[model samples]
Target: MKRLIARALRRLGWLRYDLLISPVAQHPGKNAVPPGELWLVIDTGVKKWACMSCPGGCGVQIALSLNPDRRPRWSVETDFWGRPTVSPSIHQHRACSCHFWVKKGVIEWCR
Candidate 1:
């Protein structure tokens, strides 16, 4: 019964972005990344990476770098409540081809 209810909720766009700060180096696959939640990994007070599952429901984990020194890196900004807002946009050139922006805990899909 609970499983069915959870599925229904997920289908109803229950996705919301949440923040998580981790110390050790880790990959998104090494963690349980639910839908609609973006994991922002911070190492030594510096935001290093952001990751989340594909909002397209393809189950693909998208990992983005936050290092400014690195080319093609995304930046994460957190509001007073700790909600995350990502800059530019995420373009998945892979099979899923999912492109979207996470602004203030909302996913904005690009046309």
Candidate 2:
């Protein structure tokens, strides 16, 4: 039933696999995140965190620091269409251990 609804949404151009940026003043909790969406927490013009759900379907939320001062940090770029490309790839060390790259809003899994 759910799959059918998803397919219908896809057919209607409502459901997409691409990642879209949702800027927020504050970082949202994991439960508030939706799949195929990236949340950018911007506080006073500073990019603080990039939050998103694991595309691996493990239901784990991944948050990457955007601070260059931090040892482990990531950068995000978006095209005119608002499709996001995350640099340095993402590797989940725990949970599902999914590693992938987000380029032009597409998920390229690391094998």
Candidate 3:
């Protein structure tokens, strides 16, 4: 289900793969985070990577793309801010960002 939603984000123009990076080299200040693709995802950078931003440690999230191993990972930044974090909760069910773009329009999940 997660992978499906993630893919749908790509289908629309909302979400995009923005970078080819290694945290080790890209962010050498912190722990020697094992080499992996580091994305400069728009709000994702602040929302999920607040630890990487200021010393605030505000927005933080786990990478939805891990294999349940020691290998750290990047975050999944689906554009769903300012508008609707998700569609109006309906009949107890929830509509995620995927559904939003699928219904409304692209949020330009930038980098």
- lDDT sort, best first: 2, 1, 3
Which portions of model 1 show Cα errors greater than 4 Å? 1-25, 30-32
Q: Where is model 3 poorest over a 10-residue stretch in terms of lDDT?
A: 50-59
Model 1, global lDDT: 0.71
Across residues 19-110, which tens digit of lDDT does each residue of candidate 1 receive?
A: 32222355566666776567777777787888887778777778899899998999988664455788889998777899888886677899
Worst 10 residues of 1 by lDDT: 15-24
Candidate 2 lowest-lDDT run of ten = 1-10
Each candidate: what lDDT? Answer: 0.71, 0.83, 0.27
Per-residue C-alpha lDDT of model 3 across residues 26-67, encoded as one tens digit per residue: 223443222212322233233223111111122222122222
Query: Which is better, 2 or 3, measured by TM-score?
Result: 2
Per model, state how many residue pairs clash. Answer: 0, 0, 0
Best by TM-score: 2
Q: Which stretches of candidate 2 lie over 4 Å from their true place?
A: 1-17
Q: Assess candidate 3 and give its TM-score to the true structure.
A: 0.18
